[model samples]
Target: MQTIWAPWRITYILGEKEQGCFLCQKARQVEHDEENFVLCRKTHAFVLMNVYPYNNGHLMIAPYAHVSSLTELHHDQLEDMFRLAQLCESVLTLVMQPEGFNIGINLGKVAGAGVEDHLHLHIVPRWNGDTNYMTTIADTRIIPQQLEETCELLRSGFLLEQKER
Candidate 1:
């Protein structure tokens, strides 16, 4: 038999889950912006890098209101969330040069939401053959760039857009 030693997963597998809502906690603490991996912040929403990403430059945009269901959000909230998603798409394109993208929201726990209470839209950049043997056989993904470096690039791109606007 063959084995893949993904020791880093043990932290997620056995680590004590954080209490309360991380999105809410991170949103309120501007002091820990870097530690929280927040790439950009607007009035209604913020973009955060996925701690466990499907690919390089993966991000999630969430409303600061701490709402779960999409219907709970006001029209302005929805508008801002999508605007941020579009901005994220551009930033990812410029920074990662991904051929495509997969963007969506997983509503509840049964719907595959890791953090079910706080609604978030995932922005996963896709490339040709981004999935391969590691995914099918070993259940692992290969991300080419460091999270912080990708965050910096995307953050810079995001800020540049704001400045130009």
Candidate 2:
């Protein structure tokens, strides 16, 4: 039998899943900025690094409102989500230098929404040869960077964007 060790995933395996909406809680709680991995917070929406990511710079932009459906959001909230999504794209390009990206919104559980109770957009960075033996053969992904490093790297990009404005 082939054995692969992913010690980092042990924390996730043993950790307790929190009650309530994790995204909503993270949106309001700024106390644990780095712990929460929040890169940038806007009026109606915020950009945060995915604790569990498909790629290094994976991010999600969500509105502060608790509404799940896209139609339930106010016009400005929808606008903020899009604005932040665009910012996430630029940030990923600058920090990760990915060849491409996969950006989308999963509305319902049936539609692959991890947090179906809150609406958000997922931005997954991709590269030409990012896929390798680990993902293809071992059925696991190896993120080359830690979450903190990713957050800090993307945060710098966001800060640079702010300065340019």
lDDT of each: 0.88, 0.87
User: Which residue ranges in model 1 land beyond 4 Å of their true spot?
Assistant: 1-16
In model 2, the clashing pairs are: none
Worst 10 residues of 1 by lDDT: 2-11
lDDT of 2 by residue, 32-66 (tens): 87788888888899888888899889898889899
Return the lDDT, model 2, position 7. 73
Specify the highest-lDDT model's number.
Answer: 1
What RMSD, rounded to one decimal, does every model reach? 2.0, 1.5
